[model samples]
Target chain A: MSNTLEISNLSKNYGDFQLKDVSFTLPTGYIMGLIGPNGAGKTTVIKTIMNLVMKDKGEVQLFGKDHRDFEIEAKKRIGFVYDTPNYYEHLSLKRLKNVIAPFYDRWDENIFMDLVGRFEIPLNKPLKKFSKGMAMKSSIALALSHHAEFIVMDEPTSGLDPVVRREMLDFLRNLMEDEKKSILFSSHITTDIEQVADYITFMHKGKVVFSKTKDAVREQYALVKGGNELINEATKQHFVAVRTGAYGFEGLTDDVSQTKKILSNSAIYEKATLEDIMFFNNIKTKAEG
Target chain B: MVQLILKDFRVHALLVVICLAALFAASTLYIALVLLSGNGFKTELMLYTLITILSSSAVSLLFFIQDEMFKTDAVFVSLPVSRKQLVWSKYISSIVLLLLAFTAHFFGFQLGVVINNGVGFEGAVVYEGPLLWCMLLLAVVAFKSYAFPLYFKFGMATGGMVFSVFQLLVVIAFLYSLQFETWTDQINAVVVWAEQRSLGGLFGMLLCLVVLLTSGSMPLSAQLFKNKNLGT
Candidate 1:
């Protein structure tokens, strides 16, 4: 299967913030969620892909075309939604859409109008008056109206209420039904990603901790908790991260079968959620190097 | 798309209107003062020229600020266009705005001259003999030399720094133009010098110089922008 987006060895430095060598791929028709804690270079990776931030060294290929060499052609096929509303607040939504329409050949006025109606955005009101949720809906509508096959969103639902966020995740889920559409969404909200993403790339401290399908991770990674008697240094090697409590200890292990064999009726094991995986992965990576 | 160029003008149309209105009111007041005072045509003319440059600069400044709000962020640059096209659209828009500023200034000056009742609706006396176009274009070109490269490099979020520098230079140029008699005498000598040489050659030289300076900077500005990050 062809990949919709491919990034290899990307790196960027902002004096204090550095994005170390990072790589990932999103196949067509799948949602790849980039999940991380705050300040883990998630936005930096997205920005570098859009060429919004210059990379110190790396290659980003969107649909097999280099992002820089064929920037215009490549961008024409991309629908980018920033975390913040990056639009003229003084202009009304329709007027702002008008300003954006002529840039894309595939821009559908009817589709945009449809989204406007669906989102119930005030047509005549200036964007400055919009609530954060309303502005995001408008941005997503604009992104979709361009007929782009791939959507690159940087924390699009960050500040939204839960109801709106659920609606957005559902909308994104429906978007991928076409089998030709794909989304690379970055977010700190793991539940949102866990609900829709086929693949997850967990990042911590400017480095990618793990990138795998959600199913593989969910089936493989486990959380095991027991008393201190169940813990030993030899068995500790199997755990990715360990946190000890006064009466008991809990640990994250990637191989559930191996953990089951090692702990053997002494501890309870449960499937790891994206949040558990991310939390433990961060701790593990930080402790190791 | 042309939309990128038009966005700034659309957002700040009110500010433009207000600035132009102020220009009209100030010029009218200056004319009233000159009519009553009755003894300082030379000094009055210099003051009028100074106002023209300042007001024109103000209009462009408003447009620049609004443009910065949209451009410095990742908003517009994420549009499906090359940076070259984006830079070119900005240059085209700035030139059109500069022309608008100069035209408004011309009208304000003519309004003063017509009211004065003896100057035949001419603001031509301010700069002297075909030099108005040359000087206006020169001032705009010089202003943009730093403006274009700085905005491109720093994404116009830092535009205020360069803009302040631009405003300072405009003030200095205005103060220097206070030696109006000396400039007029120099223009007279240059006109005679041109007439003595081939007249067409001097006109051609000025045109070529304007074209060279502007056209050359077009690519240079685009080149400066191409490698830089869009969101500063």
Candidate 2:
């Protein structure tokens, strides 16, 4: 399988908000989590890929074809789920299926029905009456039933309860077993991405701070703790960002091994989790000025 | 495309029902008033049919403006279908529904006329039918030029306001045009021609409707929706 999606130098601008030179790729057979802070342009990036919003510059290629050129057919293979369910409030599940099933060439009624049963969504109840988890489940069911090759979800598990979130994550994990399928799931929740993402892309202030495999991210960035006396200009220059206090200081560094070797008798290093990396990166980026 | 049409119908079913009921009630009341006032029922039926056709067309355009422009367009654009399919489906459905509403109202008006006046004034001049057809054609053109563009450019609120302004302009244009001596003469001649040969006038109106619907909606809808910002 090839790259399911390739977005290069994609940019869009609203008076005060701008997404500048944003680029990323999601390879087939893997899940790429787009982890970002609030207002980091994650939704804008997803919308651009779907052509829901116009691009001011750059290109998006899905399945090795330019998005604009293959929009009609390419869209058939792409399914989108937003943070909130976007169905008509008054429509029942059955009515929605009836309305949507005929639009997709690959729509499978049996698969849809099975999903409905599995999710335990009521067919007769209006979407407005559904709970948040149920609505998200229905959205997932619709997205999967179309046999889409690439699934793009913007914050699919943001507001769900622990059990429902676990269920959603488990379903996504199961989905990743198919080598032909790919997913770009965006979320601000580090734990959610940590569990299911094979690769992670960290975006901040409309720019990609980092994009790497989950293993590489965990291996490369590390948390460093040192005494107040060791937290000097020389030591600070070596680390990404130093959070200093009266007793000691802690910092994040890309080269934990090298930093430990240089500061052999000075600091202690520990493996970085996704959350630590994101926090320090944000702090480092903010402190640069 | 058919699925999109069906979905639109499902969403708009309540509004359609209310509009149909209103048309029927208004037409019947007008016919009753004409009979009670001792005015010829057939003449009044002709006017009622004309108003029904015009109002139905205008109302359908209004609904299109409301649905496409006002809310999050994600419901339509996020589907597996193309924008062209969605726009075309709305256009086709609106025209079909408007025509159905007009026909039903016309039939009800004719029935009421026959019951009240016994067809005594069946041959009275009926300018409203042809005039209504002209109005419907104008409504389609107005939708293409004003409402669809507003939807494409500004989303719902601004586009809806623009459409309302355009509708007002259209009415003003019609009233203003009536003041021109040549325009009045031509319109009077067309009305007289329509009265003399009612069947030919009806056929001409049908032809105009076909032309207007075919030429006005397809390309414009495709162009507008193709470039529209669906995220909003």
Candidate 3:
């Protein structure tokens, strides 16, 4: 299957912060979660792809076309939702819809109206009066109304309550039932990503750590708990990160079999959640720096 | 481009109405004072020109402030429209607004003239003529051309502060020039020369200047906007 979005060697410098040769791909009909700790440049990647932030050097292919050369055409097929909805808040939802609807060639008024009704967004109230959840729903409705083939959302689940976040994730899953739509969802919330992403791209400190299928990541990474006697400076090299307690030690390793070889089957191995992977990686990175 | 232009109008429809109403009120009051003062028609025209220009600037600035509040720049850039289209939309919308403000002033001034006629004020200048139009267009185009680049480069609040300082400097220079007879004579000389060549020639020259400034301003604004980090 063709890739929905392909970014290679993306770089952007903001003096104190930078995105360093970031690269990733999302195949059509899959949800790729871009997960990292805060300030990891996930939002920057999304912004660069949408051309909201100009890349210093890179190639971005969206819908199999160079993003820069066919920017208008590429964007026509993209549904971009910002972390914070940046709509004119003084206008009512209906008025805002009227203003934005004409710009998209495939905008479906019926779909928009239906989403508004289903999401229970008020058509007559100004967006400033909307709750955060309502505002997000409105943004999603607008993004989807254009019959967009690929949607790039930046931190959509942040600041949301668990129930609302779950519903939003469920809605995204339902959207994927079409088998042609793809999503590149950026979020710091690992649980949210774990819940909905078919693939995961982990990033840290302006660099992409790994981009692979979620099942592969799950199978490859593991958490090990064992007595302190089983740990040493040599064995520590096997774990990406290790935390020691008074009586025991817990560690994260990307290669379960290699870690087992180092530990000699003494440690209890458990599946590493996305949170565990992110936390351990962060700890290791901070320790190294 | 039309959608982007219409977006601004629809979003700021209330503000536009309020500005036009205020402009009408100001125009009506100024026209009455000019008629009551009984024959400073030249001064009246100048004052009216200043009022319309200031009103247009104020309206556009208010619209920009609204845009900043909503982070509309970020939203627009994310749309299918190019940065060039976004900049052109602003220029077009500003021109449309300038024309709207001019129309509002025209109707208001005409209303004042009708009222003055009823009050038996025969000596009042009935029509300010094409000079007013030329001055109004020149002031707005020049100001917007200079200001838009600053705004696109440095954002609305900072650019506005700088633009205000520039306006203050221009006012100071104008006042300082008034104290010098030679400067006044040179200006008068130019005006006399232009009128000698016919007012149409002068109007055409001002319009050409407007076109040139606007043409140069647009690409600069577009280029600035293209690299602008919106949320940054």
Interface RMSD of each: 2.2, 2.4, 1.2
lDDT of 3 by residue, B87-172 (tens): 88887787777777777787777777676764333322323444445555566767667788898888888998999898878767
Report how far off residue A222 is in candidate 3 (Å): 0.3
lDDT of 1 by residue, A236-277 (tens): 899998888898998899878988898899998887788887
Worst 10 residues of 3 chain B by lDDT: B119-128
Report the lDDT tens digits of candidate 2 across residue range B52-161: 64577666664565465435356657666677776677667766776666655665566656666643343433422535445444445445433555555565577667
Which whole-number lDDT from 0 to 100 does residue A75 have in model 2?
A: 85
Per-candidate total of colliding backbone pairs: 0, 1, 0
Pairs of residues clashing in candidate 1 = none
Model 3: how many Å of interface RMSD? 1.2
Docking class of 1: medium
Which is the winner by DockQ between candidate 2 and candidate 3? 3
What order do you get sorting by lDDT, best first?
3, 1, 2
- Give stretches of model 2 more than 4 Å off: B38-54, B62-72, B114-146, B173-221
Candidate 1 local lDDT, residue B186: 56
Where model 1 places Cα greater than 4 Å from the true spot, the runs are A286-289, B70-73, B120-134, B154-181, B187-215
Q: Is candidate 1 or candidate 2 better by lDDT?
A: 1
| Residue-by-residue lDDT tens digits, candidate 3, A1-289 | 9999999999999999999999888999999999999999998898888888889998999989888788899888889887656567777889888888999999999999999988999999988898888888888998999999999998998888788798899999999998999999999999999999999999999999999999999999999999999889989989899999998999999989988888877899999999999999999999989
Write the number of the candidate with greater TM-score, choosing between 2 and 3.
3
Better of 1 and 2 by DockQ: 1
